[model samples]
Target: MRRVAMMRATFPDALVTGHEPLIPAMTNDPKDRHVLAAAVRADAAVIVTTNLKDFPSAALAPYDIDAVSPDDFLLNQLELNRIATLTCVVDMAHARNRPPVRPVELLDRFSVIAPQFAEEAKAQILNQSEPSPWLIHQRREID
Candidate 1:
């Protein structure tokens, strides 16, 4: 619960509560109803998840929500805003502390989950004319 508390503290307005009454109404996996309830209460348009079976289309269609895979969602986000999406990835890499992870390294790790999106993201970062964000960051540290 410490991790949840930390998340709530970090993003106060992102929290949604009092959705338990809706849990019994959700048709997805019984174990995942709380998530569905929260999505319903939050009026989410989509629920990106690896466990597709847990959030069936029939179950979500009534609420006007779609269950999408994380890979597809990331790809969609990239397509919607290429530079901003890639920059967010670069920012995540930049925030790494104890064992710093560079953007290339982070993309490599992302491959295990979202292979196609990671490949395209890596290409965009490398193909861009500007020095890669990681290179610029490393150069700053060295100086």
Candidate 2:
């Protein structure tokens, strides 16, 4: 609840909708039906979720929506705008001021949540310039 409030405050333009109309079950999990229903209501082209298995492509084809893993989604964003993505990553690291965060720490955390994306980001970061201490740590940990 606090996270949702923070997100709403941070991204005012982000759409925040109420309960969507119930629709026929699209996946094996009855609870996931609400997700599809919300996507249908919003006419979203892609649904970014960790639970990709719950949203089969065949089920989403009719609605022109595709369920994408977070890793794939972040990779696509990185591909579209490498500099912007890096900037976002840096900003995210800076936001963790309690203990202070390093770029590599952020990447390590991302690696746990999105391994494929973390690898791709690390490669990109390495290609751009001389590796920093944090980057070195990231490489050592990932290897």
lDDT of 2 at 114: 87
Instruction: Give per-residue CA lDDT, model 1, range 1-143, as digits (tens).
Output: 98899889989987889899999999989999899899999998988888999998888888998988878999999999876887788788888876998877888889987989988887777655786566455444322
* Displacement of the residue 96 alpha carbon in candidate 1, Å: 0.2
lDDT of 2 by residue, 49-107 (tens): 88988888888888899999889999999899876786677668778888987766788
Per-prediction TM-score to the true structure, in the order listed = 0.85, 0.80
Q: Rate the local accuracy (lDDT) of all candidates.
A: 0.83, 0.76
lDDT of 1 at 109: 89
- Per-residue error for 6 in candidate 1, Å, reads 3.7
